[model samples]
Target: MTSEVRAAVFRPDDERIADAVDLLESLGATPVPDPMLAVEPTGATPAPADWTVLTSKTGVELAAEAGWTPTDTRLACIGPATADAARAEGWAVDVVPEEYSSAGLVDALTAAVATDESVGVARSDHGSAVLLDGLREAGIETTETVLYRLVRPVDAGESTARAAAGELEAALFTSSLTVEHFLDAAAERGVRAAAVEGLADAVVGCIGEPTAATARDHGITVDVVPDEATFEALATAVVERAAPSHHGE
Candidate 1:
């Protein structure tokens, strides 16, 4: 490769960075682990429901870790990967939103399922209230639980230094928290403006539109987003889109 073309892997704790790192490496860019967020168990027991919703793979993993075995509850996941995670835990997914966002999930469930059923949502401690709010607006009662905790790692803006040096060529954002904390960390390091410019200049990829919205709200341009919110697909999309920039050299 003509340039190192480092891409920031901005997911939480590098939990799912391997596949994306491999993909970026195959495309001739070195993947830098920029784990800006960390997750911890909240120790809060999740309530049961006739319909249960999971927004992230972490939620599914943590729920299963907490010995939450699905009884007769119908599972609704926010993305295909999340559905896969739910299935891996032995529960069949009843609904997955085609748009893969809060409003989309609520829309999908509103049209397809009976609204009177008891619904529950499991997510991280800082998970958005969007889905729960949207569902309630749609007349569906949802009990929400913080199944895990999300925290900004103390080293959040470690990569913003690279960013200031113009070394962050691209990045992948998996959640709103990642985008939020990445900026928070960058701002914490007193390079928020430079980091914002650098991110704007870099090829920004999001696993879903919700995250893209977060980036745009912060004035960062989003270059790639996958139809399916899977890490492999997002990584591939970013690489494919970055090819003409000589990233695959």
Candidate 2:
């Protein structure tokens, strides 16, 4: 296809960026690495607990850097990607929910650990409270340790210009913060309305439903969302929705 899809990956630089870029290229799309979020270590660590829960790969990286590793405690992750990130550090993951969301993680934990067990939820500053509330409702004690903070990017001027001129074909958001910050950036660039209209012309894909919800709330319609909340899955969703000729038609 002569019309190459260009999708903005609005996430911080990490080990996953390379993989996402490679996937987009393989699908005949240009992977725009205009990260809309910045990663900052929170100086917090996930100490050993009865059940250690990891919410994102960033958290796992920070916790490992802090000299924390999996002990006899069971490891529960919010998604398969997070689980893989944990296992990369030699931690045995005991739970990876099929749903791949905060609510799904709670169900996995409720089934894997007894109500009397303590759960240590490790994540960044943008971590959700759904799991904490869900665990509490399940009669499980939970402790949260912030491992990093995602700095929102409020200047998508370059991306907005490219989009407004029709040089962009798609955009991908991995988190709600990404959606929020991208719009904030667009407004700062004085192209919020144009960006919204441009995104309508391009394929807008999100990593999951929550991010998609945020995008819609901000008046940006989403075209694709993967069944699984992983970078690879998101890329696949974008490619499939874009219908690149190289994707076996």
Candidate 3:
């Protein structure tokens, strides 16, 4: 008899988690929906600048909700997903980095904009410093607006316990912050070491290179990082690798 393939997902506690669960079920894996991240809006908007950069879909949504528009500023997104989100709000997206990361954004902007222009970055409080540092090093004046803060939810340790108990067949990590929150939850439950041990035996997948590096730095063995840094890609790759074991094939 085949055992159920239980996979853990660490998205925010929102519709994204529901979408992830549906995707996992369609892929034949039992979804372990543990929301390790929570969004706390800072109620601030980006100041007008020569160039404006947005990093996440959530930032775009928050900005739109606050009635902030990129009227005259040239807009650049860190990835296609954020660009799509901005476009959905009737904003003209001028540039989307080909690489879909902080470094990618820096490269795209540096090549497109002059050093004399100022850049405004609007993202989460946990936004990576690579983009700002790279832009500044290129002699472009840059400022950041914290659109929101990502905090771990209070009731987020179920997956940590499951992983430590050797019940999860796979784990999907979306960002470096999610990885950190998972470890924090595990440590809170006193299962940090055991959970890392269990992850060694399971297929662990991160959305991108930076997230994979964060997992590796914390002693977790990462098994898959897809070319596209998207949740669909991460979950698909992880389920494909973990399904064989659950099916006893």
lDDT, candidate 3, 1-249, per-residue tens: 336779999999888999999999999999999999999999999878999999999999999999999997999998888889999999999999888889989899999998689999999999888998999999999999999999999999899989998988899999999999999999999999999999997899999999999999999999999988888988988998888764567
What's model 2's overall lDDT? 0.81
Q: Point to the candidate with the largest lDDT.
A: 3
Score residue 50 of candidate 2 by CA lDDT: 96
**Model 2 bad stretches (over 4 Å):** 153-157, 244-249
| Angstrom error at residue 117, model 3 | 1.2
Q: If ranked by lDDT, best first, what sequence of candidates would result?
A: 3, 2, 1
Arrange candidates, best TM-score first. 3, 2, 1
Model 1 scores worst on lDDT over the 10 consecutive residues at 240-249
Candidate 3 backbone collisions, by pair: none
Clashes of 1: 0
Taking the tens digit of each residue's C-alpha lDDT, what string does model 1 give over 1-249?
334567888776654766667777887777888787788888765587888888888888888887887786888898888899889888888899888777788888887668568788888777677788888888887899888888888866777877776777788888888888888888788888888788776778998888889989998899998987777788888766665454534
Q: Write one digit per residue (lDDT tens) for candidate 2, span 23-79.
A: 889877888876778888878888667999888877888888888877768888887
In candidate 1, the residue pairs with backbone N, CA or C atoms under 3 Å apart (3 or more residues apart, or in different chains) clash, namely none
